[model samples]
Target: MKTIKSILGILVAALFVNTAIAGTPSAKKATTLAVDTKESKIHWLAKKVTGQHEGTIAISSGSLITSGAKVTGGSFVIDMKSIVCTDITDAEYNKKFIGHITTGDFFEVEKFPTTTFKITKVAGSNITGDLTLHGVTKSITFPAKITVAGGKTTATASIPVDRTEFNVRYGSKKFFESIGDKAIDDVFTLDVTLVAGK
Candidate 1:
C-alpha cells in the first residue's frame, strides 16, 4: 500500500510539473539594433522649372527592431540643419541656396530643426510609416530593399514627399497658380540608406 501511494504521489508531482511547464508562454525572439549614423545616408532631390538641386542630409539618431532575418520596426531622426547642396560648385551659391531652403519659406529649420520617421507597418518589401516634417505628421509608404545578415541590417529606399502636405509652399505651383517658371515641384525625393547593428 505504501509503495502504491509513493508511486501515485510521484505521478501527481510529475503531472503538476508538466502542467506548469506547458502553461508558461514562450518568449519572442526580437532584438533592437542601433543605427550607425555616420554610415547611413539620406540624399534629397528638389526640382524647379530651370533645373534641380541635389544634396545630402545627416541622420542624428535611429534604431531598428528586428526579428530573425527581418526588419520588424524602426525609427529615424533627420537633422534638418545639416542640409547641404552638393550640385552647386560655387561655395557662395551653395551656402545661399542652403540658407534659403532652411528658412521659413521652406523647411524652416529654425522652428523645425528636425524631421522624423517611425515605422507603423511592414508588409513584404513595403514599409508604411509616419513621417513628421516641419511640424506636420503624415503617413507615407515606400518600398525598401532590406537585408539582414551577419549581425547587421541594411535598408535602402527612395521616398517621395510632397512639400505641400507639410505646409512647405514657398515656390510650389500647387499653392500659387501664377508662380510660372519660378515654381518648384511640390514632390521631392529622398533616397535613404540605413545601416544598423547590435
Candidate 2:
C-alpha cells in the first residue's frame, strides 16, 4: 500500500508540473510600432566604370508589427523624390546628379514617387519581403540585425538591389550592349537603418 501511494504521489507531482508548464503564457501579445521616419535612413551606392555615386533616400513613413521581442512583420515607404547625391561636393554637380537619378533615365521619380517594402516572413534575424521600386515589385530575402530594448526597436540590413530587375537600366550594359566602359553595375547596395517606438 505504501509503494502504491508513493507511485501515485510521484504521478500527481509530475501531472502538476506538466499542468503548470502548459498554463504559463509564452509571451506578450503583438504590438504595432510607428517607425521614426526622421531617424531611419537608407543609403544607396551605385557604381559605374569611372566611379560611383552614393546617396540616401528618405523614409516617409512605416510601421513594425512585433510580438514580444520578435519582429513579426512591417512595411515602409521611401520617398523617391528625396534622393540626394552625397558623393559630389560641387553643389551644381550634386544637383545635376540628383536630377538625373530622379528623371526617366533612372528611378523615374516623377511617375513613381514612392517605393515600399512589405515584410512577409521573418525567421530569426532574416527577413523576406516584397520590395517595390520603379513600379515593379519583387520578392527579396536579406539578413538583418533586429533588437528591442528600452521601449525602442532598431533594425539594420544591407541589401544589394539589381537595377535591371526593376527596369532601371539606363547605364546598364545588360540592356545596352554597346555602352563600353561607361556601363554601370546592375547591382547597387543600400544600407538600411530603421528605428521605431511602441
Candidate 3:
C-alpha cells in the first residue's frame, strides 16, 4: 500500500510538470508590434549629374507582425513634408531644395503629403511589398535584415524606386531628351531602419 501511494505521488508531480511546460508561451507565437516611429527613419537619395541630394524622412506610423525572428508582414507611413536635405549645407539652399522637391517637380507633397509601404509576403530576409507614392502603387521586392532580441525587434532594408513609375517626370531622363547632365536619375534609393518593441 505504501509503495503504491509513493508511485502515485511521483506520477502526479510528473503530470504537473508536463502541464506547466505545455502552458508556457511559444517562442514562435504570432506577434504584432507597433513600429517605433521615434526610433525609425528612412534615408532618401536622388542622383543628378551635378551630384546627389540625400535627406532623412520621418515615419508617421506603422507596425510589424512577426513570428519568432521572421517578419511576417509590416507597413510604414512616410512623412513627405518631413523631407530634409543634408547635402546642401546652406540653410537657404537646403530650404529651397526642400521646397522644390516637395512641389510638382518632384514628390508633390502638397497633393500627396505621405507615402506608404505595405508588406505582402516575406521569405527569410527578402520582402515583397506594395509601395505607394504620389498616389501610385507598385509592387517592389527588397532584401531586409530582421532580428529579435530581448523582446525588441529591428529591421533594416534598402529599396530603390523609379520615379517615372509614380508619374514623377520632373528631370527624369526617361521622359525628356537633351536634358543631359541636368537630368535626374529615375531611380532613387530609400534606406530604412525600423524598430519595434513588444
Candidate 4:
C-alpha cells in the first residue's frame, strides 16, 4: 500500500508539471516584422501651365507587423528628398524643382525630415491610424485588403490626403491658374502595401 501511494503521488506531480508548462506563454507565437522596399512605390503628380509632372517618391523604411495568425500593426517612413519630376528632362531643371519642393515652399524637409503613419486600429482588413506629414498630424482611415496563407501575410491599401492641410502650398498658382482658381486641389493620394512571413 505504501509503494502504491508513492507511485500515485509521482504521477500527480508529473501531471502538475505538464499543466504548468502548457499554461505558460511561449515565444512561438510572437509577432514578426517585414518590409519590402523594391515592391513599394510612392508617386505624386502636380500640374503646371503647360502640363503635369509625375514621378515616384522614395520610401526609406516600410515595415509590417504580424503575429502567428494575423497582422497587428506597422509603420512606414518616406524620404522627402527622393521626390522626382520626370517631366523635367534636364538634370538642372529636375534639381531646381525638387529643391524647391524640399524647402519652405512645399514639404520643408529640414523641419520635418520624415513622414510617418502608425496603425491604431484594424478591423476585417480595414486600418485606421494617425498620419503625420509636413509637421501636421491627422487621423486617417483606409481600406487594406489583408491575406494570410502558409505562414505569410500581405496588406494593401490606398489613402488620399490634402496637401494644403500640411502647409504645402507650392504650384497653386501655376496649376490652378488654368482654371481661374486660387486654390488647387489639395488631395494627394498614396498606395501602400506590406508583406510579411512567419
Say which candidate scores most in TM-score. 2
lDDT of 1 by residue, 167-191 (tens): 9999887779999899899999999
Which digits, one per residue and each the tens of the lDDT, describe model 4 over residues 1-198? Answer: 999999999999999999999999976554656666665667676554455667777778767777656667888888776777777899998899788778887888888888988888877767888889998988888888877766567777777877866777665653456565334456767766655553
For all predictions, the C-alpha RMSD in Å is: 3.7, 3.2, 5.1, 5.6
What candidate 2 gets wrong by more than 4 Å, as runs, is 1-23
Model 3 segments more than 4 A misplaced: 1-27
Error of 1 at 187 (Å): 0.6
In candidate 2, where is summed lDDT lowest over 10 consecutive residues? 93-102
Alpha carbon deviation, residue 132, candidate 2 (Å): 0.7
Quick one: best lDDT, which candidate? 1
User: How much is the lDDT of residue 100 in candidate 3?
Assistant: 92
Q: Write the per-residue lDDT of candidate 2 for residues 1-198, one digit (tens) a residue.
A: 999999999999999999999999887788999999988999999899999989898999999998887899999999998988888999998888888888989899989999999999999889999999999999999999998888999999999999899999898888889999989999999999989996
Model 2, CA-based lDDT: 0.93
Each candidate's TM vs. the true structure?
0.86, 0.89, 0.85, 0.70
Q: Kindly report which residue stretches of model 4 are placed more than 4 angstroms away from their true locations once superposed.
A: 1-30, 47-51, 148-152, 171-183
Which runs of model 1 end up more than 4 angstroms from their true locations?
1-28
